[model samples]
Target: MTLKRLILSVIALAVIVFGLIVTGIWGPSGHNPAPEQQVQTTQTPPGMSRGEYVAKMSDCTACHTTEKDKPFAGGLGMPLPIGTLYSTNITPDKETGIGNYSLDDFKRVLREGVRKDGGHLYPAMPYTEYTKLSDNDIAAMYDYFMNSVQPVKQANRPNDIPALLSMRWPLAIWNWMFHEQGAYQTQQDKGAEWNRGAYLVQGSTHCGTCHTPRGVAMQTTANDETETGFLSGADLAGWHAFNISNDNANGLGDWSNDEIVQYLKTGSVAGKAQAAGPMAEAVENSFRFLTDDDLNAIAVYLRSVPAVSEGSTSRYAQGEAVAQDLQLRGLPIETTREEMPGEYLYMANCSTCHDADGSGSPDGYYPSVYHNSVVGSEKSGNLIQVVLHGVKRDTNDGEVFMPAFGQHLSDDQIATLVNFLTDTYGQGNAQVEPQDVAELRATAE
Candidate 1:
């Protein structure tokens, strides 16, 4: 063999390999094709009609629409560590919403966190998790939004993030580093129900968007089952998204499958947890409408997860019955008001519905303060907010209402009541202060 021939062959091979790598001719396995190349404009999958069910499952309206706004006419402000960011209109309005976005554009936004104009979208949209959505599901959602949803003319509100942080270009870098772009793959060993649950929770539904804890950069710590924080819970806005993990103490350990199903379906489960704040909105707009089978699947998947404990007693263990007779009479004498204001306030305002012993109404409509997830949570935000704003849920049985005390009670009074409720019926002292109540009240206003 001639040395010249061997050298020429090696040079040719190196040039071919370099070209392949530069042009991405030999890409890694499982790489999603470019949005333009992957467009699917055909009709939705069989049996999927308007994609309304998928929208309901995803809880689209929860963050997109305000109480006074039309559905999908996004203006809801989501408060983050950096600033308040308003959701964009997703209705089919071309001027203000996504009416002009093609299926490819929509898929790009969901899968790559990039917009029609190639602008990067903030992670606040939960596209990190939505990246796992199947093409069929994304098509259905696109069809529903474009064809079924009503278009609104409302313009998007500008985000309140500071000048430096408001820049969208950095998000592209962030997505490149942290986001996983592809369709969800099923686990070979898990059952169909488990996989379905995983698809719903991890993909379209994106439950971990709120439940999972975030890192210092305000990015979610984990999005899948591989991370311990998956569904383990975190603080959102001012409300504590209590752990949904199977941990006996901190999570849903004591909850039966039926109880979890009931809670998701009805937004409340007798003496156990009742959805409130953001959770209540999710249930009202989304979970309540989910099929029974999906709800059961969620329960099953949650049960299978390993528990993440926070070293607290289970909800079942914390609620000790208080003596009825110990309930305070009329407001305490002025001399002792400073010392036992909570007792006096509870007796006057709360006990009428909650009962003197903190045991709620017999039908569990009022919900016992004891064994109540809000009261027992390590954070007292939900309890304080509920007191200030009240709670209302309409179910098959009837509408349940807790009157708002913010108008009547001073910040001190609400703080006092929260402390009393937590101390009596909960595990740890709420440690809520009047200033905290004042802050929450101001935000609500």
Candidate 2:
């Protein structure tokens, strides 16, 4: 071919690639901001009553709200590979929030990941999961936020991603490639309750955001329960979102329906597991408030999912409270920080709440270290996190607070204590090191 012909061919390829990248710009470049309107009605609206519950179910507070005083006036900064992305103000503040958004605009934001200005939202919004939300739920959410929530005039914080890498056009390609549009499809074989549970879990609650593994592109590997590895767990920051699938050993397989409901209701179920880290937040804000029927539905759906076990022994089945060494009991109570052995560390610090026998309180407030999934899991990340940061799960039962040992204990001491707990009451394979604790502590907020 002639040089001129070769140049023309290259230009054609460039045009195709550019077209693909800019495709989002060509589509419904959203409307100008709608004027703020006062909506007053004496009559009860269709979804007004259900609005708050749906918002709780969606767990919007976890990401959108940073300050207690400024609930939906979003400014929660989530760090990314590129940079930090701050959440937008979702409250109905006319100056700096979604106050001017129409119901249609709101729907588009959730379903299409598009804003009123036609810009695409990063998947951090979880619009992929929000796409499965029904029209009614979306309407209810809008109503709740616009009416009930107190809006502030706080401006949305700008992201810190590099200018060249921060271009929005490329996200169009990502959306096209990965976004699952439309509401969730109902399975014919599943019962009504199960379907309801599936709808909430797979759609609004966005459980898979944490539990489901991600692909190289930072997209969820599975969108729904039908797919393999859905809710099979993933690592977040430093904590691991435990497998919530029906897996007997690692997931919720051994949990009865009542036990699942109980766990969701109170953040702890007898002997199986207790919520901590992000899961605790989820339980406190979202799961605890769900209606009995909805909670039961979640239980049913969770139990029905295909088991994805890696080990035969249930995580809840492993571990005993047998004492290793009160031989260290011979040591002085005021042992030096550097000199305290693992068992000695537990006796000094942990044994008060967890008890000398590793069994929790008589009322089961402080959970038994034995028969606990956090202890039993092979990845000791959660165990390490709990040790460093402590557990803060506030349910109806009242605040459950475990004092963080991060400031008080050395990295070496934490590693030793966690290993002792796992070996005595969990799977005995934990090999946490001082470096691991230091690294995780460095990342802790």
* Per-residue accuracy of model 1 over 1-445 as CA lDDT, tens digit each: 2446534644564566557768877443335744443222222234557377777778878778775448889988877656788999999999999998999999889888888988898888888888877787788889999998889899999988877557676565456446778877767688878877777788877889989998755678877777777888887777778788888878887789899889888888876788777787788777877777778778878877678888866654566668543644453467346667767777678888888888878988778888787887777888899999898776656666889899999998888889888888887667888999988887773
Candidate 2 lDDT tens digits, 330-374:
656566334657777887788888888888888998889998888
State model 2's lDDT: 0.81
Candidate 1 regions exceeding 4 Å error are: 1-30, 33-50, 67-69, 162-164, 324-339
Q: Model 1 lDDT vs. the true structure? A: 0.77
Pairs clashing in candidate 1? none
- Candidate 1 has what TM-score? 0.85
